[model samples]
Target: MTATLPRVDTAPAAAVKRRRRSLGWVAVVPLLAFTAVAFGLPAWAVLDGAFTDKGTGAYTTANLTASLQGAYLTALVGSVKLSAVSAALATLLGLPLAQAVVTSRHRALREAVLTASGVLANFGGVPLAFAFVATLGNAGVLTRHLDLTDKGWDLYSFWGLVVVYLYFLIPLMVLTITPALEGLRVQWREAAQNNGATTAQYWLHVALPVLLPTLLGGFVLLFGSAFAAYATAAAIVGSSVPLITLQIADALSGNVLVGQENVALALSLDMVLVAGLVMAVYLPLQRRSARWLA
Candidate 1:
């Protein structure tokens, strides 16, 4: 302070920050553009069509009314039921499988499991349906050998669909929950035991609380996966099983009734809303899970 210190300038630093921020936005422009073109436009078309009559280019709510009634309503309910059952089963079965893989002593076995899970998770749609059919369909090899029909097991039935769904669903859950399972700290278990907690008690109290959010998140994802499924169900059970996606396809393809394209859009809108609701619930849980797991 003895001499007049050289005047400090904050202007240049502020300017540099502004420039960097602008550049950051510029870098993200392409991604934003892509999303707008790819997703936003299609979503807008569905939403717009849902409120507009197909024959008359006029706005109306008739499509939604028609979609929420009769067979459409049944399909919606069936889709929800299927998704809930499959997601729940997958979560129940996959949690232990994921835990096993994560806790395995052999690194090779872990790698193999994770690799197989990745393959299986993406191995759904038509091919997966065919694989299940070959293994369990009416004229399937297993069906011929075991005579499952006599036991009242039908591969084209609801329970059969659930079983086929689990083939991919379990693997998806395994892939998703494995990282969360790995996040579980050994020290926490040791500490719980030090405090006189038994193995079951530690897991029931500490481990479960930490893992609940992640498990719920996984369930939501699986539910959405099952809800949106079309090809696999189409290939295996066709229109026999009342599912939203199959109905939507029927509407869009004019297989149900002509001039119901707007109804298809309405169904799509309903699906979007349902999926949005699921994500709305999932986001908070996922954030909470991250706080502990991170």
Candidate 2:
């Protein structure tokens, strides 16, 4: 005795598909409009200006060439190095903390930790700078309490800048890495242990491969943040450090730099360089991410 075949219901399925397709545009249109206005226009302006000669309709490389001066080059190099180092430090510091939080049984504690991290991550610019200054500056609490003439701690130095940068970077790393670590499967660890794999071997073979892409992506984002950082460095060091952002601001003010037009051109060139670097990293990362998802 053969079983009867199940009835097919194509009409309802098609109707549901059509309904979803119809409603999709309602969400799509507004998002498209907002993106075009807010992001598209500004990006177009920047790109256009990068290629165009302000004085002449014909294009010129003079602006770009001039921006590649020793001082500007040094600033760019310093910024990239600082960002990379800071992000690396954050990753090293945050990874274990993320693993601990994800493996924790205490839900309340996890939430509390995450909340605190979120607050700190959002605390950039003047407030964060001021906080660091208050803690470690000349008249700061730490300075007043601990006096050591031999071991000098200056917030104006490159290392001091990095310290402040790490304060912000660490929180960002915690926020980014927590989700990636949480996504890791638990059985893998037990399975590795069963196979006589050491903790380092297990992580090196399994966990690290999965985590690397996300870590790299997070690092790029952190680098962008550090590179674009203006307020924090400005507030703490008061243009004494002479970062790219501070230089740009000075140029924009039209009072400090020798030539206002040249300064503007230089800033535009810096903007282009930053944009190019971001795109260079982001495009490959996006493709790599897609492969991981697949």
Best lDDT goes to which candidate? Answer: 1
Candidate 2, residue 138: lDDT: 75
lDDT of 1 by residue, 124-197 (tens): 89999999899899999999899998989899989999998999999999999998999999999999999999
Best by TM-score: 1
Clashing residue pairs in candidate 1, if any?
none
Candidate 2 yields a Cα-based lDDT of: 0.76
Off by over 4 Å in 1: none
Each candidate's TM vs. the true structure?
A: 0.97, 0.82
- Per-candidate Cα RMSD to the true structure, in Å, reads 1.2, 4.3
State each model's CA lDDT, in order.
0.94, 0.76
Candidate 2 C-alpha RMSD relative to the actual structure = 4.3
